[model samples]
Target: MNPGVADAALEGGSAPVGPRRGRLGRPSWPLTILMIAASLTVLVPLYFTIVMAFKSPAQIGSGSGLEFPSPIVWDNFARAWEMVGFGRSLMVTALITVFSVAGAIVVCSMVAYAIARNWHRRAYKVAYIYLLSGLFVPFTVLILPLIKLTAMLGIDGPVGVTLIHIVGGIAFNSLLYIAFLRSIPLELEESARIDGATTWQVFWRVIFPLLGPMNATVGIFAFLGAWNDFLLPQMMIANPELQTLPVVQQLFQGEFNTEYNLAFASYLMAMVPTLIAFVFAQKWVMSGVMRGAIK
Candidate 1:
């Protein structure tokens, strides 16, 4: 054999190089530019809000909305904090969100595990369909009845609102968990069972820990929903002291007029906690979203 031919054969035959193409068979630059523009569009409003949050009332009224404040004023935050009862509202919102997310994760994960494990059973299929049906029933349709029921039960405040969040969140979160759970191998649970672990022990020891990503995804979603929710908290709890952050922030708005600066300040304050949380848990959230998408 010719030495050149042998070398070419050894190298598996030279293939012509081509420009890289993205999944859509297009050059990547256009997509990159499009994505950058889309991100800027979304961030622009948030940037405006942050700028307004630090501006004095005078500067907000006279200066361009997009321009940075001269001699940045921290008093807007202080005033907004006091006016909105940020300390109290933060605590109320946190409590409700924490309980609601925890309850939803626990209840939905357990139900999802059971359903995934027992999917071969007709009864389990029926049960899964029944639970999933909750997803179609819009919460607005049930709000009036929920209010009446909660009032009668004497639990119409934060507790009632927390329960509502948990119940409302379960269907969707359960679906995510179920999808992910179905992808988990049953051999792990079976091995635990063979070692004399009861069903509950196998779930707690072997199954639940593997669900961390989905749990983070669901928890972030639940927290954001419950924290930003206004209608339910507004309707269920009329007590001024018990209002959540979104509900309390509305106090800055009036029928005929509004305090734009303070309202923006309050809005920024309300957003910071959730933003920080998402920043921290973004990796897990992305993983869970990808896993859910694949399954």
Candidate 2:
């Protein structure tokens, strides 16, 4: 055999074989396409809303829903702000959301910590079951009774709403906290206890501080729920002056008529705060969720 041919044969024989291909080896073009389509489907309404929000009533009425504003109307936001009572409602919503989230975090975290630490005890296990039982009960089921109770207590405004949110949120938030707490090493807590720290001191100084991601996750969820909630506020609060953003924005629509551009503008305005919140807390939210899932 020729030397060149022998060398070529040897090189070919020694060449690596690639890993065998299976279904997963092929690119999922169909799934990718479907996801893109789904994304666009969800985004189209948002795009249209943003466009309409920037448009004047005349422009919105005359132009295609999908079309961008010809001349962006900055006054739409100002007008929508006034129409929606954005100043007062924003304050109300912010107050309710802040208090509700803070209260839920403090109360739920404490409850979950207690349950997690005493999980082996029959009494604590029963308490955990009782707390978690709230998850199975729908808010709708208690609406009428809740409204009556709130009215009877004379706390039918933002205060009542905030209280309701804090209470209603405890179940899910406790669940997340419990899961995350289980992932925490017992030694850290034991060490703190050994150092003459009381249970509350150890929790606040050590365990609570370590719950940053979970706290952010819980806060985001609580804020979203409190901020976007309309039913509880609507049923409990009849005074237009005391209504939250969602409730007040509903007043912009009539049974037979609607202000399309103004409504979109109000909605756009209402969305800004929550969107900003999500943008800031998205990292923590993702991290917390992954950790919770892993635990």
**Tens digits of lDDT, candidate 2, 1-295:** 5757644543333222233335366768999999999999878988988998888777877867789887888888888888778899899888998999899889999999999999899999999899889999999899899888888998988899999999998888899899778779999989899999999899899999998767877887787789899889988886888789888877667895457878888988888887786678665555544443343
For model 1 the local lDDT of residue 96 reads 95
Worst 10 residues of 2 by lDDT: 12-21
Cα TM-score of candidate 2 = 0.82
TM per model? 0.82, 0.82
RMSD of each: 9.5, 11.8
**Candidate 1 pairs with clashing backbones:** none
Which has the greatest lDDT?
1
